[model samples]
Target chain A: MENEFLPRRVRIEETKMMTSLEKWFKLDAQLDFKPGQFLEISVAGAGEAPISICSWNGVEICVRKVGRVSSALHQREKGDFIGIRGPYGNGFPMKEIEGEKLILVAGGLGMAPLRSVLQYVLKNRKKYGEVTFFYGIKCLEMMLFRDELLKLMEEENVNLHIAYEIEDEEIRNLKKRFPERFHKGMVTTLFEKVKVNTESFVVVCGPPIMYKFVLKKMEELGFYKERIYMTLERRMKCGTGKCRHCVVGIGSSSKLICRDGPVFSAIDAELIRELV
Target chain B: MKFLKLKKDQIEDFFDSIHSFGIVYAPVKSDGKISFRRAQNFSDVSLEYTRSQIPPKHVILPMEEPILKFREEEYFEVVDDENKVLLGVHHCDIIAFKMLDEVYLQPPKDIYYHERIKRTLIIGLSCIPDNYCFCKATNSFYTSDGFDIFLHDCGDFYFVRVATPRGLKVTENSKNLFEKVDEKDMELFVKAEKERFERVKGKNLWMIGDLIELRDENFWKIFSERCLNCGNCTLVCPTCQCFEVYDELEEDLKSGNRFRRWDSCMLRAHGLVADGHNFRERTEERLRNRLSCKLGEMRCVGCGRCTVYCPTGIDILEIVRALKE
Candidate 1:
């Protein structure tokens, strides 16, 4: 039997500074993974952290300088080899909602996972219907994949809605380019601008606080509970269910976020009272 | 499965016979606490102890161990394979082993735990309840499996029940020391089990599942207020398997060992995530989570380790009874 704890070595092909805190890494490994699945990125002496795979074809992860593992990751550049135990967790239900309209909701660093989903949709463009992407970030500085989002704006049939908390020069310049798409408000505010079809499958990935407000907005907009899928985050050790740190719910209903899900529907995530 | 007998005088020889399997660790009393310790001699093993303060989970999963050793780009898996014999493990603890197996030996198996558990042999000992024990109420009083051999204490003799091939081998190898069970010996063995059942007095926690649904904040706050969050209960718990991984560097910063250490959910850092977000910030919230787990999926074996080990006098049995009320 293979040791699940053993991490495979992957060298960094390239690295980019996305924000003051977040750094993007392009690995020399092509992992077989779905949209929302994550990798347990280990930095030897610095330890491990669950980083979401941002690229579909190759292994690309965005690391936010939040804790030890990520901080150590930021220090390392291209040519550095790190150990990775991953592509774990139930990723986005891409096949399930293949033919349906997709409402992609992402906040801050949550875009990393959604980018994988969007990339898959963009690849198999003929297999999907209308695609709507709603991205929310603090400002231009914190925004990840800004160039890609801009490129996505020009794509036929795909609508990009960008929400910024602060309205600065860059935001004004972006708004001047696409007045209808760019808006000055929170992620929930973007919902008011769009005509949300109840039939559309909504995939929301964001901070813990974003869920309550976003779910409420989606509910008010008449989105079905079954169709609204969201990826969650927790302090994970073993991506396997052995470590009870990332567990959600209580008793028999308890689920290991690492094993059972990082992606759970709004209805299923309801078991976690603090979550949805 | 077959029943045999070993007289009290032949225990030393019996212990000696089992030595070929591996090192035998049995209960021993030290500093007014009972815990499993390696027996160099038969006399070192304590046969009269009701329960060990700590469960024998370390036999499978150690408190701390190195998983990997890294030097620059090269990483090597740290392997520790030691054949072990755990003697005098109570039925409650044996059941706890089964629970650990469910998590570790399932699909995406934890290789470390799987390797350790496979090499280790279990020799269960029947135990009667003390004031701290409620294994009977939790339906873990009797365990017919999860062990190679089980010994029922029958005063002058031990009524041995062999459940595995290796267990039968031990009996076969030490056939001279064993004797055929007579009617009186069987009677005494049955009586011992009856005594265990009668002495096991506590609330039936199996039906207390609804207690987790109790939204009374004050009820949980009462316990949380007294809780030091020292995480002593999790350390002593047979089934609490939460852990955190870190790295210990050698003098040369290029090389280090990635170690996994036992972590407790009671600590504030357990739930604290990056960006200073604590999902379970309040004491009552963490208390509810721990109790809900004990009441829910990770059912307490009712060994009463938490009740006895808690610095403050917080009795889980009393809490269960109160929840029932």
Candidate 2:
């Protein structure tokens, strides 16, 4: 047999330093990817790493320089080519929540993938019920996509709430720029203040630890397991199912994250011991 | 149809004749244990050996084969190799390879695996019952359908049975190496083989049905403590086919090759993520996955190769028994 898989080289058009550790890259092509699906990004000699596509419409990835591949990506400039394999893994199941209210919760870099779904909802606003966005970060400096988010929040029929963990001077000064958008507390605390309907479809993405706490709050707030969804991250070697690197515990069987899901309903994921 | 009656001394001549056909590999003694290697003489082949330290899968699916090569600006191309023969394969190993063939050559065929597989011929030797073997439990101790040629060792001679066209061709070419078999010789060979397997069954290793049912039982905590997490069981297992892929590049960063290597679920990092989350972090969880893959998955064809190669001699059968309790 012969290997049939292919790798495509895509050019990065623009780069924005989202935070101290994270940078956003806008590529030249409109990569047909769903929200919460990730791309296996390769930097020739360094290594290949999987990065979730944080922005839709345009292909962009918010990469944190944590490992060799991510660090190499941070050092690269615009017009450089990066090998991309896929927009793999199951993304947010928007079809199941089409007619329900939407609640989006993102913590720190979690906003990256969720930003895609949030953008989709905004572009097709009339298709869904009330939309509420709750985003939290470490400090004012760590907040990403500030200008674009500000413009999005200003748009009619959108309700956006932001929070930070820090009580620093820079945050105090920046609080004046958007008085209504800023709040100081943990992201889960904001859940109590927001009004959510019983039929609301909640989408959550964040560090695994943060999701545990936030998901508990959502459950307490009367959200059924079926109405909640989460995007989980795992080490993926081949975005295709051949490598078998990204199998996650789902119910009684191990589900390949590349094929079965990166996005799973809370009910489907509840039996997974590690996720809980 | 004929029965080969070559004295033990003439085994060397038999191997020399087969070598003219193509590359023939057999288990040879290395570091006091038998390992499958290129055979130059019959003295190097061990027909009475228990099992090879490594599975025969490597002869078909190499550990680190470059599936494809690509240039940055040009289209990618795959690599394929052909024409090889593996000799003296144990019954369990043959069954294990058959399982691999089903997986890799199934729908959405793995081209790389198929290229090597199609080029190779399998020559199997019926195994004498060993202390560690539990192949009977997995119903793979002896396979009548998998091998191209099956050889039964009878005191001073080899009873060769050709099963495939390739096996028949090999026999036809070595037409001078056999004599017509009589009913007396066949009866004696069958009686000896049955007695050999019956001795193995008397060891109580074959009664593992109750243990198999308790594979998912929560008694793994007790059994997991002994697991060194060394990953010896998975590496030696013929049917364990999990893998990890990565890319290597030239220093100039202008070109690179994506490659995949064998990976085991027994390791901690196998289940780790880029975002600092690991699902099977604990040793127990890793152990559970390993057991589930072997027993619960029902994928293991009961090769008994894992038990033979395990350094600690961790009897998976014993673990199953503990689970039953």
Strongest candidate by DockQ: 1
lDDT digits (tens) for residues B1-325 of candidate 2 = 3344445566666677777666888888889877778888777778787777777777776677664454552336455665666888887788888787766765446777777777677777867666777667666767776777777777877667678887777776777776567786688668767876784542233333334433453566666677777888887788877876666665665566767678888888898876666878888778767766666555565656666666666677777667555
Q: What is the DockQ of candidate 1?
A: 0.76
Off by over 4 Å in 2: A1-5, A173-180, A250-252, B1-22, B67-78, B101-109, B144-147, B152-224, B247-257, B304-313
The window of 10 residues in a row where model 1 chain A has the poorest summed lDDT is A267-276
Assess each prediction's global lDDT (C-alpha) against the native. 0.86, 0.74
- Grade the docking of candidate 2: acceptable
Please write out the lDDT profile of model 1 over residues A1-276, one tens digit for every residue: 788878889999999998888899999996789999999998988988888899886889998998888898899899999989888999999999979999999999999999899888988988888999999999889999888788878767689998988889988887888868888898999999877677899999999999989999888888899999999999888888888888777667777888989999998877655554
The sequence of per-residue lDDT tens digits that candidate 1 reaches over residues B219-276 is 8887789999898988899988889999988998889898998998899988887878
Please give the range of 10 consecutive residues that has the lowest summed lDDT in model 2 chain A. A245-254
In candidate 1, clashing pairs total 2
Alpha carbon RMSD to native, model 1: 1.3
